[model samples]
Target: MSRICKPYAAIRTFLLLLCGWVPLLTALGAAGQTRIYDIRYGNNAIGTLETKQETTGSTRRITLKSRVQMKLLSRMEVDIFAEYRHNVLHAAKATRLQGKSSADSKETSTEKSANGYTVIRKGERSILHHARITYCVSDLYFTEPREIRQVYSETLGVLLPLKLAADKRYELTMPDGKRSYYRYEKGKLKEVEISHALGKAFFTAREGA
Candidate 1:
């Protein structure tokens, strides 16, 4: 009878520990905020874009992922990741893959250095002469840049010009002489129109929030 009681007591103790951790585990899982966008070409749905942000103490992590069907047989995907500590850039990386081939992939990485920032692309390294970078292209998806004059492009490894257009929308000029327009409603990003040489693509908020 004593042995039976001991086993029952151990079972109760294990259940108590499990109950204590359930809420903490749920909170940890819910630590990030995610927003989804539907990528469209004209009236056709081509792909989806998802962005997530998570913050722990003073460090913040932001990630963006998207897959687009460029043509009947051509598929392209993009993944971008950035980390910031105390509102300053720590490191960022971007990768672009064509179709299902890794040989047709391109990657760009940027890291914070004591002097400024180091950008690596195509196995070559270059220095960016900046004291600090507080805002980047990824931040534009979550935060409306009404007063921001310039923003860092993690993919291009350079700064791009941001300006308010005559129509009250924000436009960012890319390195390839193409301009992307961002439209915000109620201080939140609602839609983005990106122009390509072949056509245009739009990213509309899925939840409309």
Candidate 2:
């Protein structure tokens, strides 16, 4: 996967929780907010990600869209939509397209059930029980900055330990030995730093954009 795809994968998994699990935590105010971010690899402007959230009655919806142009020939795009009702995820959908002509594409859809959550990807079905699942991608402390010791990663589909520093930053080490750092300000995610073998990639919020 490309560097841009890594964060999108994680975000896609978290959208599942946002659609289904965020309501269980706290109620967001009626006001809606949107943020635009620039994804950079070293000094190159590679892509942009736009995130928006809105609330109506007891339902909350979040949408994210990103497009990246890599090198001179390859391009990738991702779109995610999530909906929640009374703190329970109602439905969510994500689609990813790669290549100049979008020759390769994959999509995943999730729905909440009375028993648990159902996820469909590439024609495979899986049941995720609330009890069996200990954490979610939301626990990374981006939206929820409360103290958390571990997080469930939807990309890797596994539980990983998280280290929180005194400055309110959270760090996680990927399976491939790469480390990613997350920072938030005023309870909103501000930046993400991803370190890979090549170098560090920074995703920073573009204020007023």
**Top-lDDT structure, candidate number:** 1
RMSD of 1: 18.6
**How does model 1 fare in lDDT?**
0.69
Write model 1 residue lDDT over 41-146, tens digit each, in one string: 6677877778787778667777888766634446667788888776688898888776688998888888999879999977899999998887888777677676
Each model's lDDT: 0.69, 0.60
Task: Count clashes in each candidate, considering only residues at least 3 apart in sequence or on different chains.
Answer: 0, 3
| Candidate 2 structure quality by residue, lDDT tens digits, 84-162 | 6765556667777777455487777766776676777776888766533433443232264466565544433334666
Top candidate (TM-score):
1
For candidate 1, the TM-score is 0.81
Candidate 2's C-alpha lDDT? Answer: 0.60
Write down the worst ten-residue block by lDDT for model 2.
Answer: 12-21
Give per-residue lDDT, candidate 2, residue 172: 64
Candidate 2 lands at a TM-score of: 0.75
lDDT of 1 at 63: 83
